[model samples]
Target: MKLRIKEVIKEQGLTVQEVATRIGKSKQSLHGIIEKGNPTIGTLSDIAKAINVPIYRLYEDDNDLSDSPVIICPNCQTQIPIETSIKIKSYNHD
Candidate 1:
């Protein structure tokens, strides 16, 4: 699931360093969570607080499927099969 941290940060006009400082984490650590999608619960909670958004906003409902497929590594411009694209790591490896 996408964390939507970047979106919130942009919407709020908050720099990564600003949020990181507010949440008591290094800027690099917060960037890793946003780009790499592996933040601990505590980190996520802090992010939620920083953004003034609920934790659930970071997670998409499994039953709510979007019609469009999400493509990664668009260098190939390949239409990745959504049903088979199990994880972000798989997409990154493509």
Candidate 2:
């Protein structure tokens, strides 16, 4: 799953080095986090703080999905569609 961080970084118009400095990490370290693609929530929180955005923005939104309910993988940023089927069981007890 991907965090879509690269896109956010680009949108923010801030270079990786700039963010790394704000987050107290090195550019290499920040790149490693993106390369790993499996950052912890705390890590994400830190990034959000550095980028001055809500953590949720790091994930994909409705614009990224189609007819199905889709969730983005934090490590790979792939959209996974969820089944929207309902199952109901009717039982009679006398």
Candidate 3:
């Protein structure tokens, strides 16, 4: 699923570096997440905390989360696209 990390960060007035530091990740690593759309659960959780947003918000589809203008990877310190490599699924065993 596409994540809205960049939009949430911007909405919270957070810089990529700040989010990276808060999440114990390098800017490059975080950038890779933005570009590659693959972040560890721990990283996503930390990002959720840093931005004061729910994890689901990051995966919301209505806001064009994947089409965000930029993303910073803490691993590689690069800015890249937010297209997601994995699809999100909702569990409803009813």
Candidate 4:
């Protein structure tokens, strides 16, 4: 699967160095992983945790996401309409 790590990082206004520090990796190492466009499961998990986003979010393509704000039911997989707003929380990778 194509990982959107770089895009998500940019969208979150986070630098690779920030994420690298959070994940206990060097910036160069993180850049290598991003440049390769593939990371091991453990590395991906660390990145997700570092960024405070659900793992699945990294896999979602912006083009594939609908413009409408809707929540997907976990069990039945139904799309439920909901009022929502894009709120970017301050990154506290402490």
Candidate 5:
């Protein structure tokens, strides 16, 4: 999975150094993790906390899946097909 660490950091108006400081990592180490393309769950969790975003926000939305509607799971960041999403409209009589 492609993690959008850099993009999310940019979106949040934060610099890599700021986030590195928040997560207790050196700027060079953080850059290495970003360039490595695969970080452990613990690392991702730490980054999420530092950036103040759900871990799912760090995932790059799959462009190939854009043709189909999908919903992201907040916990695991797995994409759920829209058809499989439970409908609540029927429960809303109002």
Candidate 6:
């Protein structure tokens, strides 16, 4: 199942309607953009402003793991990467 936007919105304790209103986008339009995972620069900026975070932070945290399998620490809100290739290959997200 896909839930990228849902997860972010949930973390912010906001609803889709609220964010859409903040960004000046219609709910249907926002839903489409979020599901496609391709937001315009203006949309990103709007979302960032609404969420009270930097534009970059709107998508990801401070961690720059690049090509690693990273997981966000639910407790500390830090991104941690599984460094070993074997570990990454064997890790089960479910």
Candidate with best lDDT? 5
Q: Order of all candidates by TM-score, from best down to worst?
A: 5, 2, 4, 3, 1, 6
Q: Could you tell me every candidate's TM-score relative to the true structure?
A: 0.58, 0.62, 0.61, 0.62, 0.69, 0.55
Between prediction 1 and prediction 3, which has the larger TM-score?
Answer: 3
Model 5, 1-94: lDDT tens per residue? Answer: 6878999999999999999999999999999999896777788889989989876677787665545666665467578776655656556566
Name the top TM-score candidate: 5
Every candidate's CA RMSD: 14.6, 7.6, 11.4, 12.1, 5.3, 12.7
lDDT of each: 0.67, 0.75, 0.74, 0.75, 0.82, 0.65
**Clashing residue pairs for model 4:** none
Better of 1 and 4 by lDDT: 4
Q: Which tens-of-lDDT digit does each residue in 1-94 have in candidate 6?
A: 1225556677789988998898888989988988887665667667768866544444543344344556544344455566664444566798
Worst 10 residues of 6 by lDDT: 58-67
Of 3 and 5, which scores higher on TM-score? 5
Output the lDDT of residue 92, model 1: 54
- Per-residue CA lDDT of model 1 for 20-81, tens digit only, reads 99998899988888889867776777887988865555544343324544433224323343
Off by over 4 Å in 5: 63-94
Candidate achieving higher lDDT, 5 or 6: 5
| Model 6: per-residue Cα lDDT at residue 13 | 91
Which is the winner by lDDT between candidate 2 and candidate 6?
Answer: 2
lDDT computed for candidate 4? 0.75
- Candidate 4 lDDT at 5 equals 89
| Candidate 3 lDDT, 5-86, residue by residue in tens | 8888888888999999988889998989977888776678789998887665566465453456445455653455655478
Error of 6 at 77 (Å): 23
**Distance from true position, residue 79, model 5, in Å?**
5.2
- The residue-level lDDT of candidate 1 at 89 comes to 47
The reply for model 1, stretches above 4 Å from the true place, is 60-94
Candidate 6 stretches greater than 4 Å from native? 1-4, 60-94
Q: What digit string (tens of lDDT, one per residue) describes model 4 on residues 3-84?
A: 6888898878899999999999999999999888767767877998888875555655544544555554445434566676
Model 3: lDDT equals 0.74
Give Cα distance to truth, residue 63, candidate 6, Å.
4.2
